[model samples]
Each structure stands twice: as structure tokens, then as C-alpha cells.
Target: MKRTTIIALMMLFGISFSKAQTSPTAEDKIHSFVSIKNPPTFPGGMAAFYKFLGENIKYPEQAKKENIQGTVFVSFVIEKDGSVSNVKTVRGLGAGTDQEAERVLGLSPNWVAGTLDGKPVRVKYNIPIKFANKTAK
Candidate 1:
């Protein structure tokens, strides 16, 4: 009886360990940005751009008070050389939301370069930023 119990526990442990090692699915990879080449260039790179947003972004106080929460989708092009350009809003909820999205993206730092056919290529990327009103809670 003791040997049987030990073998059962070992089998359970092996099964659980194998399950933990499985790879993530494609959907799990969507939210992250991975560059094929070195990091791309922007006027100020990501840090400077984020700083610009931090300085300029005004949280819609009214929206926050009302607990408005939504995701803003921003699309922009990254040049072949890795420079950020042509930023625009693909989706927005308003309440000064679109402008806010544009402002944040425009101020984004350069991204790591992308590649096509193993060569550097310009690509358009889209990102969604979520805003939640903590005050409402």
C-alpha cells in the first residue's frame, strides 16, 4: 500500500510538471511588442516620449469622476530605419480620448526595428491603451 501511494504521487507530480512546461498560445503573444532587429529610433526614444506624455497628458477629471473606463487604439508607422512616424487614432471613445491617445503615441520613443524577409522594413503597428477611473471605485 505504501509503494502504491508513492507511485501515484509521483505520477501526479510528473503530469503537473509537464503541463507547466507547455508553450504559450498565439493569443498570449499578441499584446507584447517584439522587434526583429535592434531597437528603432524615434525623435526621443520611448523614455523621452513617455516623459512628454506624463508632462502633457491631462487625465479627464470629469471622466475619472464618472468612472469611465475604456481602451484607446492608436496606430502608427515605423519607418524602415526604426523611426516612429504618422501616428493616428484607429479607435476612440471621446471625452477628449482620441486626442489623448494621439498625444501619447506621438510622444512615444523609437521602437526596436522590425524586419521583413530578414531585412529591415517599415511596418505599421497598433497599440491599445486602457484607462480606468480609480476615483470611481
Candidate 2:
């Protein structure tokens, strides 16, 4: 009986150990691109991307009224699944331009995820959003 109980316990322990080894945790799944072979891309290209931005960005009324014009810098992570996340302003222009920049970026479609050694990985990208007030001098 003692020997049988010991064997059963050993089997249970072995199974649990095997399960732990096979299952990866969230920490192990982080696939950020510190060094990458290729950069991420939009669906069409850079020109199309800029065009999309131009078409989508609506000049904030407050900004237009105040004649605020400058560049807003934004940073975000393009995940391995081609989804954008962690969007933030690295540098911001006031008069509602900063919030507008964040809004426009949040509306952006997923980009082609970056590649590290041919494997898809999350990459951090920074971009400057230009705010030009055509009506203002």
C-alpha cells in the first residue's frame, strides 16, 4: 500500500511538472522587436498612409479658432498580430491638437507587424503629426 501511494504521488507530480513546462505564461509570450530584420508597414504604402491621415484628421475647432499649428509626436506599438496598441503622445501641441492626434491614431487600421528574423514581432513606432492651419498665417 505504501509503495502504491508513493507511485501515485510521483505520477501526479510528473504530470503537473510536464503541464507547467508546456504552458507558457504572459511574460514568456512578449515578442517585442529590439532588433528587427524588417520594419512594419501599412496596407498600401507610405503615400497612402499619409493620404489616409490627411483625409481622416479633422482640424479641431478650438485649434483653428486659436490658430494653433505645430507638430504632434505620437508613439505606439504595432503588435505581432498587425494590431496597434499603447498609443501615446511623445510630444504634443496644445489647443486640442494633442487630443486630435491621439484620436486619429486610434482610428488607424492595423499595420503589417514588424519582423525579427522573419518572425512577426511587436515594434515601437514614432511619428510626427503635422497640424497646418490653412486659414491662419
Candidate 3:
């Protein structure tokens, strides 16, 4: 009985230890631009980045018809591998503009990952995408 109890306790302890090892801790969730030494950037500089957005982003038909015009603020995480994820709209305009902004960011290419202490790390990034419609005079 004593040997059996000891074995059971050992198994329980081993399972708990493995669980702890696999679970993410507070430190593991520490991806933020505030703590990073350098923030992520697109392949080119801001000028080129804005040009890319203008070219790739499509004005939603509904938004265009409704004459919706405003800037959509998007927030996303740039991973250590330079891939983007967790895209969300912090501020949005109606008439499908919010969805369009998210779509454009989703289709963006991998950026230069942010760095912390010169080591590549995930960082949070925010950008404002503008939508405007011009009618003939």
C-alpha cells in the first residue's frame, strides 16, 4: 500500500509539472511596443507604406455610395517572425469601411519585426487608414 501511494503521488506530480511547463506565463505574454527598443516597419518607409495602402485598399461599394469618409484606426500584433496577427479596428466608420480596413491590413505583407534589446520580438502597432470619395464638380 505504501509503495502504491508513493507511485500515485509521483505520477500526479509529474503531470502537474508538465502542465506548468507547457502553460504560458505573464512574461511569455509580454509583447508590447511600449517595452520594445524598436517598433516594426513595413518593407519600405512610411511614404511607401502609405502608397501601398492606397493602392491595395478598395473603397467599399456601400461606403462609396453612402459617401462615407473618415479614417479607420487599426491595431495589430507584429510577431517575431514579422507576420501580422490579431487585427482589430480601434476606431471605425460605418458603411463597411471598418471591415475594409481590417481586410487591407490582413492582406499586408510581413513587416520588419520589432526588437527588444536588439532581439526580434512581437510588438503592437496601430495605423489609421483613410477612406474618401470625390465626386465630379
For model 3, what is the alpha-carbon lDDT of residue 38?
A: 87
Q: Higher-TM-score candidate among 2 and 3?
A: 3
Worst 10 residues of 2 by lDDT: 26-35
Off by over 4 Å in 2: 1-35
- Candidate 3 residue lDDT tens string, 32-75: 67766688888997688789889988888998788889899999
Better of 1 and 3 by TM-score: 3
Per-residue error for 69 in candidate 2, Å, reads: 0.3
Q: Against the hidden reference, what TM-scores do the models get?
A: 0.54, 0.74, 0.75
User: Can you list the residue pairs that collide in candidate 1?
Assistant: 39-112, 40-111, 40-112, 45-109, 46-109
Ranking by lDDT: 3, 2, 1
Q: Which stretches of candidate 3 lie over 4 Å from their true place?
A: 1-27
Candidate 1 lDDT, 31-100, residue by residue in tens = 2135444434445666665466656666776666666678878877776656667788898767776787
The local distance difference test score of model 1 is: 0.66
**Angstrom error at residue 67, model 3:** 1.0
Residue 57 local lDDT, model 1: 66
Once superposed on the true structure, which residue ranges of model 1 sit more than 4 Å away at CA?
1-58
Please give the TM-score that candidate 3 achieves against the real structure: 0.75
Residue 22 in candidate 3, Cα distance off native in Å: 13
